[model samples]
Target: MAAAGPGSAEGTTGQSALAAHLAFRSAIGDVSGSTRRLSGELSRLEASTPGIAGRASGLFVRYVDHGVLQLRWMDAELAAATQLANAASEVKDPDMQLALLRRAGPRLQAAMMGSLLLAVWLDFLHLTDVALKQHIYSVEWLFVDLDRVQKMLKPAMTALSSGESGQVEAVARDIPALVGHLTREFAATREAMRAGAEKLQKILVLKESIEAITLLSALKFSLPSLPPSAPALLGMSLTVGGDGVMMGTRLVVSAEWVEMMRHLVRAGVLSLPTVSAAVRIQAGQVMMAQSHDELPKGVCDALGDGPEVQGMHVTGRAGAGMNEPPRHHILPKEFREWFEKRGFTGEMDIDQFCVKMEQANHEAIHGGGNWKLGRTWPGEWNRMILEALQKAETRTGRMLTRNEILDIVAERMEEYYIPLKFIPWRGP
Candidate 1:
């Protein structure tokens, strides 16, 4: 039943990797597949940056690190996109599926956004490298680049945070143009540096100090005249595979909705970080909406009057829960089987499991203590809750409260960027 999503093994049949790649490209409307190409380029750049050293190398290093983080965030968002796709796939309602995909639009847009910053960073680094090589490094130029980058960063962040897919997509689409401009400039500079280095070779003299300043070993400037240990720099190295590979391998999502379903099979393979609790919570809400009307009487009986769906939002809507018939707590056999499948083989009956979960949740929220899952593995708790919901849906033919699902999943929300673990600027 759940095999309908993009990543499901059932869909892997006779389709070639190239065909699958094309299918995915079209489903998300990314015709150029620019983001994936950029990701591969960034991977190459990341490998080449470490040995570079000059007056502004520290800043360049930070840029590389920041690029990596952005990619990591993109990877996290990809997982979320997959989940959104999968949830949409599992349901029978077209309207609901569209709603889920619409919600997914912003995240998909955000996933391709890392390259924008990477491009800006590359431009700044190239300029700085040129200044250092030409012995014209200036402090004012540093701040100018910083200002320009920061200005661009704000809008990019806004796009990332926004749910407006069209807006985000526009921002992402503009990246390739900037990449083209910077790439041409980069090629010109590299050539000039190479020619200049060849001229200097005749009169070259190795010296420890350029003037009054004693050159430190760590501050060696990468000269353009020298053969690159690696191939080309970031901009010039963006060339993808051979012509045939590029032609046969072009990603194109079909116009048909059936093709879209084929691309969603592998959704939700990536694990979300603690900071993505909101996404998880939101997903839970969406899932609940799907099963709400179809919930079985027996499953309702199991949860009792106050089912206490974890992560469920508290609303003041009049007669929300009050109008419903009194709920009774009873563990059904199907619920037991579901837990067993998840490796919850202890003697704790269904009622005991519910009580423990509710009690742990109560203590965390109301006990004025450090809020944690109070379990050895918080992930286990989350898995149980989602699994239980799935079981309930199967037994009762209805979705449960997704907000409450968040209550369980939201047990541990972490910051997306931890200051202490970030760039060297954060300090050890």
Candidate 2:
């Protein structure tokens, strides 16, 4: 066969690039539709069963909104890539055409990163759906049992008042049995719900980690080699403009991403193995182990006294051969007056609303990190919690109850990838 000229090769490469772009755009559209549908479903679930559904439904909706924003950015980049590809095709000089196509490489890579992020998010949504459904079922069953017990109570009281010995005796026996059954069921359901919530939190951390990786990848922070078990790059050719520049399919592990992952691993957000396993889970190549129920060591260390206020201790007390993490005020101490005005008064000592945390995690939350993250994530979390509190008070037209405030704190912690165990426990 005669050798293909540069012009002919350029034309063929451009065509393949266009085809890949179109396929990716189609995939984005599909994911966008799915995200919108899931958001709507979650909204409905949140509205209908606000009490039982808790915050997961609403949190997912917010997550979907964030994902959609990412998709919009992706679409813009893809459009740019398509335009550049077309421009390359119109150029007569092979060198000029090649240069134009080369310019599209980064754009295409960005779009690909967005696609990967959306795919991971969609997997998270599926997992959230399952967990939320289970939670709803468990709470609903508890309500049903409560109603049944209430009905039984009235008749039992009547038999006792009427002095019907045999009836009272039988009724007493049945009541104890029912109460015992209810207790056991409630404990089981409560434990299941807790586990589900913890699972969702860990998965949320994984999702955020993947998002960070994708962003880093788009910024060209990647190794020439791929990571272990990394999936194929959707069978798309990354080479463009007749130059052998590989723009995609490399493992993205920027120094910043690596540092953040190291911090997370050390802080017990998720273990290193869990991170790898979770990625595989998103790729549909593996399942999470059921036996992984214990809180991360960092979390356990933070929850030292088990979320209870067992009297006040020194903020950063270290024991022999042990480094004690510093205690962080869940509601910042500087905002103690503000929280008190919003009903942290009386028995609600803001000082008691604290959790132990590794120094790095604590510093990060307080805006001590990379300038970009410090400006955004930490500030965003603070704003979110404050806004949530303000909105709740506005809706109820009153200061939040103690439990209500605790619930808000807990929800925000989960949303921001903080350990739920950090919230002060107030009994079951």
Candidate 3:
């Protein structure tokens, strides 16, 4: 067989590199599509259950935003690499072709690492989605358990307080068994939530590890060669082969990276903050119920006697306290005409729909004083609510009912993290 010429050799190398590049690009595309789908699913889940999916929603927002930047950078680098590879394929000179291919190596490696980081990110998203759903289901069951226990206890306590001997004797006997059942169910649910949190923590650690690797790879591609002193500055080895060949390049994690990881692990950085918040909220609810039960009957009755303002039983006089904030209309009074045209024509006076909030928070909602809430603030929220109303009307080709409008308002309020208590009470 005739010996292969320089052209033939260049053709083989270029073809191989180009094929690899195409495969990596294809993988990136597949992963990108998966991320988008997963993100949409997470968003819908959040929409359905606002505060329940807070942790997962926060992570998705943060990482997806970061991923966008990384992917863009990777795409640009890979495209440049492909161009270099193509250039090498056309050139007949052996040394020039090698130089071009060498230059392309770092870009390819950086892009490859970026793609892997995204794959890890995709796994994180999937795990978070599963974990969030499980937690929500478990928490819902816990609430059910609490409700059942409360229902069982209330009548027994009432019987005891009212001095009804027969009713007391009847319920007292069942109390022990009921308490035992609640204890078992609550313990099991707590265990499940704990396990789910641990899983999330593990995935969070894995994500960080991959991020570190990706960052080091990027440094390698950008710097190509680091002096001996560079290790101290970057806290990682950034050396490559003398001939500029990136194949078989070894990256040594610096002491700093290991120590930083240790610190984060020790600090419980991997623990989901939102999960902890949910647990605290649940605990607070139980405490609140207990406190309410402990209140004197007269006080309980008095609580209900507070003057009704905008459908809320205002327990405290508006001007009784220092620096009392005035009540603000939920739907801005200025927009009353606009809202009436769409569906605010219910029996309840539009002006009376108000919620008492802090002066700063109230002002922030109305686009006052350095409002920096981005797309979720007064401006975007206003647009969103109006659009929702418009869409609802268009779909039915009729104005919305009072309840329907309130439902829309509630959803938007939750979406923007406004307190749900601010929504005017619907009559029983």
Candidate 4:
């Protein structure tokens, strides 16, 4: 599995998150390895440039400081998962503990994806300078491969459940090898950075600036064992040409790339419907119903994530209905720390908690975008990203501090997602 952060979940979500966090941490570990290597290489690449180091100082900082956070977030996730897993081992219930462990895979996958996209955004805007891009491309090209192996996990899991341990082991073994490459490449990158003593001249007389928009295309494979749209949900696609050596001297991101991107937007938007919000709303309604009386098997199957639903149970004890005031209303200090995340106090209070949680549940398992992001984007994620860029004055050589960068990432996340929501959990 690729590295991921805690993903779109926090607190004691459940058993699956345990595995997810493990996978997530693994991915983040790679991010660190890659970032360190890239930095070392960039340092070498700029060694001979007369003014480039000072010119690109802020860019380098962004790559290093910002990149390191990916690893930290992964650590946070692993910590959270470890806590949950340990707690789960104490549950003493045979079936339930195993079920919890099983859920870890999906959560782990979601976390890995969120980290990748975050990396993409960071790299895309890091420093559009050529050597920097080359350094980034060479190192990050590996991050993209995490998806290939993770995709296989589902098939392996399906096979494992249906009596195919050999297949599961085959895929599981592939994960470490792929992940190790990320580490090994970074070590090599570090060496490359140290070894390169000469710098190339800036010869742009023959090359033009890259095209702004390029098309990224991908191939879709449908498998019968998983959900019908699973492949599409996993975001498998090929990034075809939009680049080439125009005069054997310069590279270009062409108009053709823009057209391809446009096609993707058209196809994706037309073919797929946004399901996260709907799922949350539906799940919330079911929880409300179940709290009232006996929930049907179908409803239980859909909304029976006993762990997430138990937040109310944590505060008010199990069997407490929406109408009842919570008996134990202690929101974690961390939860209360978010600037916009106000404490729970019972205005639809627990009434809507289940709905808020429902979205995350679907996102983790079915590969929904809401949960995949890992960041709780407010309504202004895009605006914040631009604002950060502007504040950095990256083009002008000014840069934000580490706190400022994290603030931007946080604020941008808000713009990317929905209103504040909650789900309390207790796990191993």
How should the candidates be ordered by lDDT, best one leading? Answer: 2, 3, 1, 4
- List RMSD in Å for every model shown: 19.3, 26.0, 28.1, 24.2
Worst 10 residues of 1 by lDDT: 418-427
- Please state the error at residue 421 of candidate 2 in Å: 54
In TM-score terms, which candidate is top?
1
lDDT of 4 by residue, 79-153 (tens): 443443343354433222332333232233323332332333232222223334334323343333323333433
lDDT of 1 at 373: 40
Cα deviation at 282, candidate 3, in Å, is 41
Off by over 4 Å in 3: 1-60, 136-428
Mind sharing the TM-score for model 1? 0.36
Q: Please provide, for model 1 over 206-271, each residue's C-alpha lDDT reduced to its tens digit, 9 standing for 90 to 100.
A: 121121111211011112122325333211211123321111233111224233322332221111
Q: What is the lDDT of residue 198 in candidate 1?
A: 52
lDDT of 2 by residue, 156-214 (tens): 43443332223323332233233333334333443454565566565454345334433
Task: Report, for all candidates in order, the number of backbone clashes.
Answer: 35, 0, 0, 31
lDDT of each residue in 1-428, candidate 3, tens digit only:
78555479646644444443344344335434544544454454345333324653443344334445445655665566566555545544433344344444434434433343343333333333443444533444444543454454445344333322223233333333333333344334434545655665654543453344334221223221223344343322122233221112432223332232222212221111111111111222221122221222222222232332112211223312234456566676657887787545532345435555777776565566443553355355455667788899899898776556765675566565675332232233
For candidate 2, report its TM-score: 0.27
Error of 2 at 394 (Å): 71
- Please report, in order, the local distance difference test score of every candidate based on alpha carbons: 0.36, 0.42, 0.41, 0.30
- On lDDT, the leading prediction is 2
Per-model TM-score, in order, reads 0.36, 0.27, 0.25, 0.26
